[model samples]
Structure formats: structure tokens, C-alpha cells
Target: MARQVQFDQLGGPEVLTVREVEIAPPASGEVLIRVEAIGVNRAEVMFREGSYFLQPAFPSTLGYEAAGTVEALGEGVTHLAAGDPVGVVPAFSMNDYGTYGDHVVVPASAVVPRPPGITAVTAAAVWMAYITAYGALIDEGGLKPGDHVLVTAAAGGVGLAAIQTARRIGAVAVATTRSPDKKQALLDAGAAHVVVTDEEDLPTRVREITSGEGVRLAFDPIAGPGVDTLAEAIAAGGKLLVYGALDPRPTPLPNAALYPDLSTSMFTMFRVTAAPERLRRAVAFVNAGLSDGSLAPVVDRTFDLDDVAEAHRYMESNAQTGKIVMTVSHAPDAS
Candidate 1:
């Protein structure tokens, strides 16, 4: 029997349950992975809380990103072999086939080889975060060289990835944080400038920094009333990517603040992973960056599996410095 986190109800982290389950061998085009490291995202939280676009049936598995070694390959799966290290982007649905488990079965197409030089934890964290950022920054927003970017909730998983993407895309990254303590953490994570949103006038300061030209893009994950800050800071014809509403309140928009309308688009990793071509492109892009040493996933902390509840609580408390990963079988020997 394999163990996994499943939720029978929609609510807080307490709704998540680790239970033993039976799984059949992989079918054609599928592979079974012995999951190692799992990346926790805001989407999983949203899914858990029943606030996401996808409604949950009782007793559904909960997770989206993970890295592991292939345990078994199903018929017609020729591209991979057992024992191959792989990264999973499990955005297909909220069903039993998720990354937060001891073993998971997925289509071969949903699995990408973990980059050669990257660790399992980092590779697990990379798939969803990097792809989400790429789809929004490159494909949707058309982020270009010399464009300035402002990111809200800039210290979280996808938030950190957005900052790295901005750097690679030749954009100036100005990241925001509600936590006064994470100010330095943001700078260390490749942000060109850090704005502690709760402490400063975000729009005014952003305008001052860009000399009134404003940022070309604002990547907002925490879409609450705070979105107004980013909306006001965008340059004319800029894009505002609203990916997540971590805050419970509806996002604010200062309607009359800008002359030309600020271009805004809804972004989600689920959407990024919806089509096969998009998934392929994202895997190629992130893998290439990994191969060349240009991209890296930041894992702030790792916890043992039984401590999963603690990890969830820590995440909700917002004290993490970077990605908070959960290690199942193979954690680095701390000694």
C-alpha cells in the first residue's frame, strides 16, 4: 500500500490526511514514481480551501509538483526507464494522481527528466514554479529586455521563480513583501529592488524608481486589495498577471489611476500545463536554463514526512525564506 495526502473535505490544512491506498501498475503511456521531494504551492492551498476554479469531490489527493525516480514504466512508454530521475508537473487535475504521495502514477508526457545538476528537491520545486512564471512573463506578457517588473508576494514559491525569470528575461525585478523580515531574503533571491509593501507607498516608490515611467509588468500572486498598488505602478501598456489570490479579499483596482488601461491577464500553472505543446515548451525552456546554470529553484526549508502538518502551518504563518519543501524518503543527512 502507498501512502498519500488526501482531503475528504474542503477547508484548512487540517483537511489533508495521510492514508494508505492501493494502486495498480501503470498502464500504457504511464509511469509510476517513488516520490521524493514535493513542492507546496498556493494553488494546492486554494484547492484545499475550495476557492479554486476546480471544485473538489470528497477524498481527492492534494498536490501538483514533485521529483522522484521512476519505479515502473508502463507499456508503450519508451522514452524513460526505471530508476531515471524525473520531475513531475501534476496539473492535469485534482484526482488521485498527485505528487504528494509515496508513489504516484502519471502519463509519461507529464514527466520531465530532472536537470542533470539539480537536486531532487530543487527539481521538484522547478516544474510548476518555473513554468508558471515563463507562461506569464514570456508568452502572455511579452516581457522584454530592459522592462521593469514588480512582483507581489515576491518571496513565495512562484514569486521567487518570477524574480529569477525576470532576471533571465533581462527585466529589472522589483519585488514586494508584506513581511518586514523577508526584505533581505528578496534581495538575495535576485530581486533588483525590494519593497516591503506594508511599510512603504508601493506605487509612489515604484514610480520614483522608474522615474515616473512605471514598471512594464506586475506579477501578482496575492490578488487582494493590494493589487491596486501594482496596478498603479505599471507603465503605460504594461501587463498585470494575476495568478493567485492568496489574500481572502477581492483584489483592488484603482480605476482612474492610469491614463492608458493596464493590460491584465489571468494566469495559472494549471492553464500553463493544459496543452501538450505548452508543457513541452516549458520543460525545454527550464531544462535548458538548468543545463546552462542560468536557472535555479530555491528551497528554503525541508521537513520530514510526519512533520507535514508542521510544514503546512509554517507556510500559512508566512515565515519561510524561500520554497518550503517536504522530503519523503530521502532527506539529506544533516549530520
Candidate 2:
């Protein structure tokens, strides 16, 4: 029997129920996946809480990206076959593949050839954060080499991806985290400097680190009321990108400092992934980046498929340094 994590009604992590679901064979241009690992993201947390872009239907399947072996191929599908290793990114919605399941059917566009060097757990976690970072920084933010990127929420998934991507392009990386503990870890991920904003002053610390030149780009996901400090610290004519407001409060832009000339770009990946070709490019970009060693999604910890509630709780705590993941296989025996 094919089993998956589902919620008859959306509310919290506890609402997720893992049970058997009937499997349908692939249609034209789709392929079936045997899930090895699934990524648990804060986006999943937001989806469960009904704050994400899409609302949950009763008994909706959960998960956006995963990786596994190919089980079957649909007609007209090229470059993939049964028994191949691949990453499954469920563009559009989780119902596209219901990747939390043991098996799923996904469009060819949603799949990428997962190289042997990358584990399923790492492959599943890399796509979303990396693609979102690539789109926001290079495609949208117009980041250039020698640019200084100040990334908020530096220990989180996007922050981790941003650090590696910035380093890949030869840009200076400055990452921030609430926990003073993850500072060194961020540096280990190739950050030029790691800022523990909860411990250090934001503007003053950024200025000190940048030697008062200020950063050329600020990639902010935490848009709390205090983000004016970020706006205050942005170097003249630099860009600011706010991808989300994880904080309950809204960011306040002081009019005096909020110059019309300041470039600020905002977006949701859901909107960007709508184009089938772009989705394919996202898959290609991440897969190539991983294969080349320039990008690797950090896996903080992996829980069993049955332990999704604990995974959600852990992610909700915001203490994890990188991607928190779930695997269909059993959790590793403790030491």
C-alpha cells in the first residue's frame, strides 16, 4: 500500500495523518517516484497554519519537494526511466505528487536528475531554497560579483543557500541569525561574516563589519517592525528584497529614510514557478549547482516519516541551523 501524510482538516502539525493512499500510474509526461526522503520546510509550517499562498483543502496532501528513485515513466517522457535516481520537486502543489508518500506520480517538468554524489535527503532539501535564492538574488535582485549581500535569518534554509550562492558568484556574504550559536556554522558555510543580531546591534554591527561602506544588497526574510534599521543601514542605491514576514508584525518604513530611489523587490516562489519552462530551469540550476559543489543544502536533522509532528515542532522552534527533513526510512539509531 502507498502511504502518505495527510490532514483531513488543516490546523497544526498534529493534524497531519500518515496513511495509505491509492497510487495512480503516470500519465503522459509524468513519472512515478519511490520517495526516499522528504524535506520539511517552514513553508510547510505556514501551509499547515493556512498562511501560505494556497489554502488547504480537506484531506490535502503535504510537501513541496522530495527525492527518490524512479519507479515508472509515462508516455512521451524523455531522459528519465524506471530505476533512475532523481529529485522530485512538486511544482504547483503537493497534490502533484504528494511526496510525503512512499510513491508518487510527478510531471517530467517537476523532476531533475539527482546525481549519485548527492543523497536523497540533501537533494530534497536543496531545490526550493536554492531556486528561491537564485531567483531573488541574481534574476531579480541583480546581484553582481563584489556585491555585499546581508542576509537576514542567516541560519535558516534561504540564508544558508544565499551564503553558498553568494560565495559561488564571488560576492561577499554577511549572514545573520538570532542564535549566537549558529554564527560559526554560518561562517563554516562560507559566510564572510556572521551576525548574531539578537546579541549584536543590527545597523551598528553591519556597519562595523562592512567598515561603514554598508552592504550592496540586503536579503531579508524577517520583516518585523524593526526592519527600518535594515532600511536605515542599506548603502545608498542598494537593493532590498523582502521575501516573507515570518514575524507577526509588519515592517515599518520611516518615510524620511524611505527614499523612492531605493530599489526594493518582493516576490513569492509560487508565482514564479507557474511557468513550466522556468520550473525546469529551476530544477536544472539547482541540480547543476549541487553537482558542481557550489551549493549544498545543509541538513540539520532527519526524522522518520511518522515523526513529522516532531519535525514541525522543531522547525517551529526556529532553533535549527539548516533544513530539517523527514525520511521514509527509519531514523538512525541514536549513536
Candidate 3:
């Protein structure tokens, strides 16, 4: 039996529960892993509350990222072996397989060997955030060196990853947040400038930072009426990439009367993960960065696997400056 997190209905963090259940062996094209650490994301909270694009089946499993050692490999899976350190990518559907448990069986394609020198916690935190940022800024936005790109909600995992990814590509990263206390931390995270939205006007400040030309690209997660402000902040012919819906309200397109040259797109990491060639390039890019120390995963805090509900609560609190990780412990006789 393996301890796994599950929820039978839509609700808050309190809905999450841990249960010991029989684990299935790896099926063909799948591999079983003994999970050591798990990354917590805001998407899981949306999934639990029934607000995500993908809804859950009753008693649904919940997770997308994990790092562990391989325990077994199914037929046709020859690239990995027992005891290999590995990490789970968020390429597969959560309804099909989840990494919330101490042991999980996932598709062979979604498992990648952990790079040397990265711990389980760091490995668990890397893929989702970096890939999401990479897909939006590089793949979709066509971000280039010397160009300015805006990263909103700049304290979260993906936000910090976006800053690092931009810096790695030589682009100028302009970050935004609602709190003044996080300003210096965002600057320390490699952002060229930090905008505390609560204290300043976003468009005006962005214009000042860009010397009136405005940023070439703006990546945002809070989609709502505020999109107009972001739209106003972009240079003519620039693009706005909206990747999330943290605001939970209606979003509006910019008035053609104001900025007809502006372009907007809704982005998701699946754009890269769902495409074979894109996924390959993205993996190669991130691996090279990790191996060279150009990219680093930031883990803000950790919780015991049994305290997953609390982890979810913390994520919802919006106080975390980086990725929140959950550590899984296997008692000698529990597995």
C-alpha cells in the first residue's frame, strides 16, 4: 500500500485527505517510482476547487511534479533502470496519473533522469515552472536579448523562472508584484526592475522603465480587467501572453481604439509538452542551463507529505516567494 492524497469533491485545502491504498504495478510503457519529494503548484488548488480547465473524477488523485528513484520499469521501457534518480514532468494528464503518492506509476515518456547535483526537492521544483516560462517567453513570445519583457506575479515559481529564463537569454526582465516588501527580493532574483503594482501605476511605470517605448512582451497570470493595463503597457506590435487566471474574474481585450497593434495570446506549458520537437528542444535547453548553473530551482519551503493540506493552504495564502515542496518519507514497513 502507498500513501496518496485524494479528494472526492470540489472544495478548499481541507478537502485533501491522505489514505493508504494498494498501488498498481507498472503497466506497459509506464514506470513505477518511489517518490521522495513533490512540488506544489497553484494549478492543484484550482483543480481541487473545480476551476481548472481539467475537472476531476470523484476521488481524484492530485499532483503533477515529483522526484524519486525508479523502482520498476514496464515492457518497452529500456532507457531507465532500477534505483535511477528521476523526476516526473507535467506532460501527462492529472486524471490519468498523479505524483501525490509515495509511490506512483507514470508513463515512460514523462520520466526524465535527474541531472547531477540537483536534490530531490530541487528536481521536483524544476520542470513545471521552467517549462511554463520557457514556452511562453522563448517559444511563443520570440523573446530576444536586449528586449524588455514583463513578468507579473514575480515572486511565484514560474515568475522567478521567467526572470531567470529571460536573463539567461539576455533579455531584460521587468517584474511586477502587489506587495512592496517583495520588491528587493524580486530584484535579487535577476529582474532588471521591480514594479510594486499596489504603489504605482503599471503602464506608467513600465513606460518609464522602457524609456517610453514600453516592453516588447508582457507575461501575466492574473487575467481580468487588469489585462487592459498590461495591454496599455506593451509597445506597439508587441505581444501579451496570459498563462493563468488568478483573478477569477472576467478578462477584457484591449480597446482597438487605444492599441490596435497589440497582440494577445493565452499560453499553457502543454504548448511545448504536447509537441514532440518542442518538448525535445525545451528539455535540451533546460538541461544545458541546469548543467551550466545558468538555471536554478528555488524552493521556498517544504512540508511533510502527510501535511499536504497545509502545503496547499500555504500556496493559497500567496506568501511563498518560491516553489513549495513536500517531502515523502517511507517507513521501513509502510511500503
TM-scores for candidates 1 onward, in order: 0.92, 0.92, 0.97
Alpha-carbon runs more than 4 Å astray in model 3: 332-335
Q: Which has the better TM-score: candidate 1, or candidate 3?
A: 3
Query: Candidate 1 has which clashing residue pairs, if any?
Result: 224-251
Taking the tens digit of each residue's C-alpha lDDT, what string does model 3 give over 191-245? 9999999999999999999999999999999999889999988999999999999
Cα lDDT tens digits, model 2, 49-121, are 8888778776788788888999899999988888898886647575444677778777787787888689988
Q: In order, what is each prediction's RMSD in angstroms?
A: 3.1, 3.5, 1.4
Indicate which candidate wins on TM-score. Answer: 3
Clash pairs of candidate 2? none
lDDT of each: 0.82, 0.81, 0.93
TM-score of 3: 0.97
The TM-score ranking, best first, is: 3, 1, 2
Give the Å error, residue 1, model 2: 2.9
Off by over 4 Å in 1: 252-258, 330-335
